[model samples]
Target: MKNSKLLIIAAFFSIYFIWGSTYLFNKIAVTEIPPLFLGGIRFFTAGVLIMLIARFMKISLKLSKSQFINSVIAAFLFLVYGNGVFVWALKYVDSGFAALLASTQPLFVLFLLRLIDGQKMQRKSVIGVLLGVFGMYLLVSQKEISTSEGSVLGIFMILSCVLSWSYGSVFVSKADLPKNYLVSTGYQMLIAGFLLGVSSLIFKETWISPLSWSNKAQVSVTVLIIFGSIVAFTAFNYLLKVVSPEKVATSAYVNPVIALLLGWYLLDEQLTEQSVIASIILLTGVYFITSRKRIAKIKVTTKSQKI
Candidate 1:
């Protein structure tokens, strides 16, 4: 039990730090790498590595036909479109700004899940979602107001990315995934990688290029594969085994904080007062929306047991 608790804490920090740093890495990578190619290489290599590791562990790789199809659908929605747009958006926006927008995903998830599951939306959850949306507006539009112009298309693309990811998350939760998390993730990554690679060929001209051995690009790609893909994912899987989903999901709130700090310190990105205020409001809103439901459920269960 103690070890499980320790693992959960480690997983939380890993997800928080690794995912936060990915925004910076993506920003640097897109400077020289094409967006689709960057995503393709990242996912493809990570998938291959994960598969090899699974094989070494003697894990079965076979999947039911339905599972395969579902994995592909989830991958297409989450990775191909979701991560694809993220990399593309990073080309236009600051990494900090992009992450801020992406962080609104929990709001989208809550709204969509309520609709699909036919779950009643609590008043607190609705207010939280509204506050979060307002916070997002403040963060994005503030920069536009100051600069007198902004990339409205870029904002839309990032929000689309968020929506795609939110849908994917809900779908994954509902889908009957393989019991082995590593195997499931490996298949999803492979499917997503293949689709992204094909999209790169069709939509992007520079799918493959002469390899450059620059230190910055090399470091960024290496960190993304090792820390972002492998370690963070493994940690997340472990976390789910040891902790409740609610606790693990708190990484949604923590990741943005890490992203903002890393962006400010390492990338020299400026955080306006509005951005700070928005972050707080958004996190608070998420807390209310996600936690209130759990709290209510617990109370009801306790009262029923007493009866």
Candidate 2:
């Protein structure tokens, strides 16, 4: 159990760092590679690699018809559309800006949970949502919003991505997952990757130039695949098994900070005082909103068991 806890912590940090850095990496990759195509290829390669490993492990590839259908739906919402929006958004926004906008996902989830599960929104959650929105306002205040050539479209796309991802998370929790998360995730990735590839080909011009590989780009892609895709996801699954989903989901708050710092240092992106203030406000809001219910639940459970 101790080892497992350590592994989960490692996984949390891996996801937090690798995923945070992906926005910058995507920005760099798109400098030479087309957006949709790059996304499609990345997922496709990762999916195939995961599938191959599963095969070697002799994991059962079988899925019930219902599970198959659900997986396909998850792939569409989570991978194809969710990630698709991010890739599209990166074409217009700075990496740091994109990360900041994507951070609003927790707020979206809070609203969705309230509506769908009849979960009562605590006062703290409402306050948190407000703070998060205020943070967004601060973050976007300095940038000129323009649909034609700037962060405007990017912001919209990233918000859409957040919504899609939040919805996908709910679906995953509700759906009947296979006994093996690795198998289920592998299938979802494979199906999603294939669909994304096909969609990219139809919607955008594809490019893969051997000469386009810079040392940085190569390093970025490799890191994203290894740490971002495989290790982080594996850790996430492990954590989900042992920890509450709410705890695992806390990474949503931490990821933006890592992204901001990394973007500032590595990409020479500017971090304004407003950005700092906004981040604090948003994080505080998130803490209040997300933790209240969990804390309540824990207290109730303990009382009931003691009684």
Against the reference, the lDDT scores of all candidates come to: 0.72, 0.69
lDDT of 2 by residue, 92-192 (tens): 77676677677677677767766666557677767766777777677767663223377776777788888887777656655655668777777777777
TM-score of each: 0.83, 0.84
Tell me the tens digit of each residue's lDDT in model 1 across 224-306: 88788777876765554443333344555556667777877886777678778978887786666655544333221122110
**Model 1: lDDT to the true structure:** 0.72
Best by lDDT: 1
Displacement of the residue 226 alpha carbon in candidate 2, Å: 1.6
Runs off by more than 4 Å, candidate 1: 1-8, 127-131, 134-138, 141-150, 208-210, 234-252, 272-277, 295-307
Best by TM-score: 2
Of candidate 1, the 10-residue stretch with the lowest lDDT total is 298-307
Instruction: Give the lowest summed-lDDT range of ten residues in model 2.
Output: 298-307
TM-score of 1: 0.83
